[model samples]
Target: MTEHDDDRPRQPGRTVARSDPGRAMAFSDAVIAIVITVLVLDLRPPDTEPGGLLAGLLDEWPTYLAYAASYVYLAVIWLNHKAAFTRIREMDIGLQWANLGILATLALVPWPTAVIANTARTGNLADERVAVALYAIIGALLCLSWLVFFSYLARHPDLTHDHVDDDYFAHERPRALIGVLLYLAAGAAGVFIHPLVASVIFLVLPVFYGITSHGYDQGPSFLRRGAGSAKSS
Candidate 1:
């Protein structure tokens, strides 16, 4: 459909607005870039004598671990966001707010990621677990924001491109639901079990997230794919 066409299939009680999502996508990209940059800033140098710098770095393995895991997780989140927008055709009030919600929680990520790293490095099991619990709570919020964004689109399926299946957004619900549940379970483990275990759970979250991609492949789309390719080139 042409950019100006109000091509989204109409449904009872649904209002369709012809919107260009490019601006919204660009704004989201900027916000996500800032968040990723802040995450890198959280990596602190090992404070030690010149000769002992190697040992100091070794002692701060937890910091490195947390940084790596968080970095990868954020990467996955970005990829997922891009994948979703590929099918999204317009920016409505609800979708705009939903996107903001995801960004809000995502912006909080660097703080908790750093906290987890610093606390884990102290080698205090109790404090580490508390830190893990805090991190898990942040993760839950992030996942919840994603769930909200997806649900909003599901309820208003017309926001997606005509080439996309109406049920596409609805299919995403289960993964988002599972993500919330897993985050809660990890939080429980942090509070009751060991923080190290909870850290592992956080590290593996991207893999669990991959489950959502199983059916997202639509063999590329005439509307979104060509534009995406041009932008990339």
Candidate 2:
């Protein structure tokens, strides 16, 4: 009688499951959308007299600034999240939890955003410091979540496809470290100095990450490889 493979404790070279990781991405995207929608809903209309619409809008620059900053932050997170998942071929329970951690941090963004807007409008440096500190804390948590997720993926190569090599981790791990350090520094600045400094730091990060991310190359290379295969066939 022929022996079945189920007798083994673990397969010597088990292939990653064929299920696409799109469902996770879709769920993440939906959550992100809802979070952003909630953020916009938090924006209160400026209290003004009749025929003062333009002046009212101009007077509420703080609200606009906070909204723009938070919006950009969310966009950057989504971009990096999409980039990371594109390289993944499979998922595990740990990865799912990491994703949830990130989402939880993101869900907290609206509160700080509202705080900053309210304090900015009031021109109270003391309250502004508190607001900035809160925002920076959230930003730090978000960066830490990303760091954890990347480190987890790097430590577990089996969760990813074959194209990802040691080089990928060597590159990504340091990148995550840099992000964490930068966020910490910004948080400190927010607590010690003017909040504007921290806001500038937060705004600058996406530009840095955009330029330096290894994730940018990962997605297109797969497309190139597939195109080459089609031509060869």
Candidate 3:
């Protein structure tokens, strides 16, 4: 639809002075770039003061694992972020604030990454478990923000491209729900099982997330209706 369309849908009890999202998206890109870089800089090299520097490097496997997992997870988030904006056509104050919520939680990712690395390195089973749990907690919050953002778009279709399916946003909610629930489950696994196992869960989750990031015209399998079925109002 053209920008001057008169019959644009809007949020109830809200004004409809939407603006282009170029500035907001550029700002978001900058924020994410800086946050992702922090993990790399946080990768401190193990001291080579021992009889062999090779052994010290080998002992940094935990560090490698934490950095790799966190980095890849952030990459998945970035990919999904780009995909989300492709459907967004306009920006409002609420949408802007919701985007900020994502950035806020994402910026803290490095802290938990460092915690996991250090705790695992010290060979502290209990602390490492707590570390993994903390990481999972942050991941859940991030996913929740994503859920809120998508839900907002679903409820306010005027903020998105006219060509996007009316039910598209509704169907996307399950992907975020899966993340929130799985992240919580990962936290429980960390507390009750091996921290390494929890980390592996964290690492594997991004694959599903990335796959689900793509849009579906009808919806996901579970959310899809039968052939010729009607969409409920």
**lDDT, model 2, position 79:** 80
C-alpha lDDT (0 to 100) for residue 64 of candidate 1: 82
> Which regions of candidate 1 deviate over 4 angstroms?
1-5, 12-18, 211-233
Candidate number achieving the greatest TM-score relative to the actual structure = 3
lDDT head-to-head 1 vs 2, winner? 1
Q: Give the runs in model 2 whose Cα sits over 4 Å from its true position.
A: 1-20, 213-233
Rank by TM-score, descending?
A: 3, 1, 2
lDDT of each residue in 50-161, candidate 2, tens digit only: 9998898898988888888888778778888887886776677777888889999988999999999989889988898888888878877887888788877777666676
TM-scores of the candidates are 0.87, 0.81, 0.89
- lDDT to native, each model: 0.79, 0.75, 0.82
Clashing pairs in 3: none
- Which candidate, 1 or 2, would have the higher TM-score against the true structure? 1
On the 0 to 100 scale, the lDDT of residue 58 in model 1 is: 89
Error at 170, model 1, angstroms: 0.6
Considering summed lDDT, which 10 consecutive residues are worst modelled in model 2?
Answer: 1-10
